[model samples]
Target chain A: MGKTMSEKIFERKVNHAVQPGDLVIAPIDCAMGQDGTTPLAIKSFLDMNAQSVFDHHKIFFVIDHNAPSPMESVSRLHDEMRSFAQKFGISLFDVGQGVCHELMVAKGLVVPGDLVVGADSHTCTYGALGAFATGIGSTELAVAMISGKLWFKVPETIRINLHGTLQEGVFAKDVILFIASQLKADGANYKAIEFHGPVIDRLEMDERFTISNMAVEMGAKAGLMVPDDKTFSWVKKRSKRDFESVFPDPNARYCEVVDLDCSFLTPQVALPHRVDTVKSVEELDEIPIQEAFIGTCTNGRIRDLEVATRILSGRKVHPHVRLIVAPASREIFLHALQMGWVEEIVQAGGVFVTPGCGPCVGTHQGIPGDGWNVISTANRNFKGRMGNASAFIYLASPATVAASAIEGKITDPRKYLR
Target chain B: MSWRGYAHKFGDDINTDYIISGKHKFKTLDMNELAKHVMEDIDPNFYQKIKPGDFIVAGKNFGCGSSREQAPRALLAAGIRGVLALSFARIFFRNAINCGLLVLECNTSPIQNGDEMEIDLLVGKIYDHTQGVQIEARPLPQVMIDILQEGGLVNYFKKYGSFRGV
Candidate 1:
């Protein structure tokens, strides 16, 4: 049988033909741990009594989860991470650098056809560049740091073909939310999803990143797209690394095929406590929100900011709502500032925070009050996701969030769109 | 090896966020401190109700969301001997195995809250002492068994010098 994208990537990594369900120990191109997981990984690394990391250049430590140290205890963990990074001579992306996954891709640390792993679930975000990336636990990350190699059970592939153009104000977030509704939480357990068809090809790198970032929400090991000219140019602008892109054979064997027509899709929202409980924004009743957030690894890119900015430019935030905007990285933040998107957003009563995962991870900054409702563009909507189990989180597109912020209710972005 | 515990049953899609909330993640990394808050959102008194060697029984998709190892670590610290679910999110399943916490997939519907249960790791069987019945569980692969036998991946790495059964 012809090989799928993941199978092809694994075959190349191991330098042998492989099939689904085969376990192979392959060298990892890059491995990372964020502040939330790194401390535990350091503990496990010491517990293993490892003398040194396999390679300093291949491992990274990022401090974005609880950036700037919300408290003394978190600060101590940050210090521990800094010390470990210094001792091992590994690269450290300190606070405000951005979310770990965004920094990894923005820095070009990962490329097509490479095997990558991170200690955060959204590490699957890198698959937008066609890399076979997935998330593992801190202990597993420790193993990767020591050996630069990890074993994997080659997962079967699920091919999702996206056809047609998205409607006005609908975006990659909507597409992913719609998919999540159909697939549910555990739909793609232990499997890799390869997105294909015209819609995927037409999507920009930022949109692709948003889609791939949420693959983990569907229980996918990796959500990948075939690297095309756009992907190549995007990576080339960021890094001078020589890399090869892998694609599935024409007759590739997929366990299942899902075809989605994006033309019919509308602004989607995942209600409180469950990502799979998605509905079209227009179909929902007047669900008032106390906060509207536009940020995170999922939708914190420049394009995402531009969309939110366009919606909030002249209109003030609703009296009952707080609009918070955080760019995915300092680079994106500076770019948005140059474009005047930040000023316009802030002028419209949106609060701009440091470019990191603060409110999204609920470490510090902008957490909702108890019994409040929040509309966010972040990926997951699991119970207590935003640090307050009593508060509710609704997942939507950046445009939708901005619209909702303007009205203080779950409003469709198309109403604001010209 | 066998483990006996009272089942602390829960419903479907019990994500890691519900297992341990994000608010507590930054407050402390001490497993014991985290243990006190384990499942606090789902059941406020969860930690107080379970004794040493207890089990968490739940429906489908147990331990979904995020790659936080703290979820399993906290459960282990809270004296949860094992988790029996209809299924698990992929990352959580691997994390549980890496932490040396027992995770089994079976028809957890047959298990009830506070039921006395025993799990035979070698035989892949769960005996519900309270229900007076037994159920078969999905068996772990030899590699996972090897890692779990050593009380987690770190110990397994210390003993074997590399991952085995790959």
Candidate 2:
């Protein structure tokens, strides 16, 4: 049996040996709740008649989706969440802390080889740090708050080994998008994807996060990267808090493995209805779109901003295109403004929205009407996800999305990588 | 948010966006408009077929994504009696219980889809008429039972808070 990093982490958490099919209950080290669900969870916790939260420090309640978007409806939701937080004295990040995924990693809430759970499906996003993270319901989160334990089946591990460095204009998002497109939306359900290869080794923490963040999009349990200097340096900067680090032993077992040679890889996109319905940019042309959005927890990092700015350096978005760029958080937004990436986008006539899940959740702040086709950096281009079921969504890398936003058609980022 | 119903069964990792969806995270211009979409995503015509007061028996990790209370709220609106699963997502479980939706956990469900279950939530047990199974849930605290019996936290607060809600 070739134990992958995930299996090892699971073993440590449960304090027992585990196989792919074995069921195990492990204590969730960190529990993250976003505002969309926090108020309700807090209400439930309060309703439970518990004197106080199970543990104060273990819960991270963040208001990410509607932060700074003071629509009448948005404000109501925030007000409710705020009331709950104030009542409970829970760890809350309300003031433009950024998307919970990136924010948690940057703030040192996640530790390698830890079992983390969240109220959001994207809670699996923390897997980038090699933590076993998965999404749970608010009910489970409530239980986790009170009980601090989570139940999960020991999932089969899929070993993905990549060879060759990414070509110019291609980044981690593209790589992950391609992987999801190949695996299909439900490809790796209840499975752990152990990412290996020199390509991953060279990836920066943010890039690894971009990939691991979307592992759940493939219906995966988690994605893990072996701890290296990048992981070590990233951790060192965050905390001196000491916890044991985990690594897979040499003779660990794996249920399956696949290899990809990235030397020939290029820009790819997943058309609607399914994330795995992939097509290369080279094959798509003149697919005119009404809207282009370049931001989401998946692709709204500072690096994503740099890629978009690079693509729009000397060109303006097409006249027919309505483009919106929402940074992921206040830090990213302010940093981009300080770095002038936001200006480059604005100068190109793109509307730069605030850092919440503005357009991604279809809150209608950036919604498109009937007959619209949108290209976004967010995941889940499902039908009717973005306010219009008739409308089409095309998912692409930040560079590809930026390039397409400029041209109002599907285009490769490498074509404008200069 | 208080509920009295029979339990129905389901599988694990029941995601919220999958249950109700992020689009319906808040009160909508049209409430019933989302019912069909919710059913379509989970089970088409689920709203119509699911009997009132039937407990939902599910596997583990139920309600696995987004803290969207709308999922359970939708379930309550759709006339689910209660949720019975091996486990629940943190928020969904709490929200359902808060919103007067009865959510119970049994080690395993002997009741199947059409089981005539009579659940005495106050007693924390479900009498499965069809399967002759009587499953006991991990009982909630007495105060919680009062909160549920009062039709949710709001009603409880309204009665207890001296009209602070007003």
Candidate 3:
């Protein structure tokens, strides 16, 4: 029996071959906690009464979820985080840096074959670079911070091969939404999803991140794409960290294999309240929307912004709709500003929030009102997720959100795309 | 470890948001306070109705969504002895163990709402006394059960100390 990419990653981390269902103690290459979870982790660390962290450089505390301090209490949490970081000499990315996962990848902290763990579930996002990353609780993270090693039950791998080219208007967001629809919410429970084939090769690194970011919605342990030249180029431009490329064995055993042809895919939308409740843009009714949001860790990168910029270039947002644009990271925000994408989006009546996890976690910024139907490019549309249980949220691509912002309703992006 | 409780049933995909609403996340960090609102959205009286040593039984993918440990923490605070589900999200399972909450993956829903159940973690047995059914759940690894026996990972670390880091 051969090994999958994640299996190989665990093997490298543990210095031995691992199979699915095997429980092993693997050395952690990187561990992180965000503002939403870090305070608890810090508390756990203190409760453990440990003198110091295992490795200062390998651990990180990011203040992104409630970036810029949503309130005085939250600011106090920030102060606590800073004090903890300073006390332990751990890396701390303050407010406005970016979401933790994005910062980790952009800063070159996540290399191929690295064993990464964070307190946030989307920590699986780093698996896009071929690293075996998964989310754990704050206590587990605190344990990692104290000991630098954690136990893992190596997960079975489910291979998904994409063959056909993504049709126009059908962005990477659509591909992931389509996959989620097929898998339902719990389809991949406790399994790692590995993407393969030419279509995955064609997706940009940012696009791959978008796919892996949503893997949690399908209950996957990790969503992995083997490192290729594209991944190498992205990492090379970001950091000078030395790394060895990782790939699965030719006969790597998979629990199951799913074939997805992107050619037939259209811009997909996850209906209100459930990610798996998906419908194509054409098949859905044109329901009016009170708000449209185009940003988040899932679809707030430079390329996504450019897509929004292209759709909103010559037009203004509808007077009735409130459109919010949030760049995933400050680097992406600066790049958008330099490229004039920010200016174009602002001129088209899109309000820019801070370059953090804006409105995605729903703890801060641009929350929708009661009974309002809003379209967003964020990953989850779970009830009460956007700070309001009465409000409805629809998930789609940045282009679809931008077009809907202009139309003040749920409109397909293909009509707006040239 | 062993537990005897009545089942409080829930359906599939009971996400963390429903477990402990984000609306109350910033209000306080008190686990007991958050327990007052556990599953408030799904069952407005869930917190009020839950008794000490109650067991939460659910369909597949229980505790799915954002890795807010509060979900499991709230259950522990609310005196939920264990959660028996067809499956669970990965983070929730780990969090449950760390928080000293028991989670068993049952191959079937052997117990329904209000049914009396007893679980023996050491023996990997679930006895649905009300339904007169017996189910075998995957036994937890000895390491994890040891940690749980120590009242979660923090206590385990306190007693055993931690691994030296590089």
**What is the number of backbone collisions in each predicted candidate, taken in the order shown?**
0, 42, 0
lDDT of 3 by residue, B1-166 (tens): 6889899999888999888887666545688888998887678889888889999999999999999988899999998999999999888988998888998898656577999999999889999999999999977777778778888988988888752221
**What is the Å distance of residue A119 in model 3 from its true position?**
0.9
Model 2: residue A258 alpha-carbon error in angstroms:
1.5
The lDDT values for all models are: 0.92, 0.73, 0.88
In terms of docking quality, model 1 is: high
Task: List model 1 lDDT by residue over B1-166, tens digit each.
Answer: 9999899989988989888888897677799999999999879999999899999999988988889999999999999999999999989999999999999999998888999999999999999998999999998878889898999999999998787778
Fnat across every predicted model, in order: 0.87, 0.21, 0.63
Compare candidates 1 and 2 on DockQ and give the better one.
1
Instruction: Give the alpha carbon lDDT tens digit for every residue of A241-326 in model 3.
Output: 78886799899999999998889999998998999999999898878999898887799898899999999997999998999987
Q: What does candidate 2's lDDT look like per residue over A62-158, in tens digits?
A: 8777666546776776777677667667677874677788778878888787788887767777777778887765555665776677556688888
Question: What lDDT is reached at residue B22 by model 1?
Answer: 82
Better of 1 and 3 by lDDT: 1
For residues A306-363, write the lDDT of model 1, one tens digit per residue. Answer: 9998899998999999898888999999999999998999889999888898598776
Identify the superior model by TM-score, candidate 2 or candidate 3: 3
What TM-score against the true chain A does chain A of each candidate get? 0.99, 0.95, 0.99
Per-prediction TM-score: 0.99, 0.79, 0.97
**Model 2 TM-score on a 0 to 1 scale:** 0.79
Candidate 1, A294: how far from true, in Å?
A: 0.6
Worst 10 residues of 2 chain A by lDDT: A43-52
TM-score of chain A of 3: 0.99
Instruction: Show where candidate 3 strays beyond 4 Å.
Output: B107-110, B162-166
Q: Better model by DockQ, 1 or 3?
A: 1
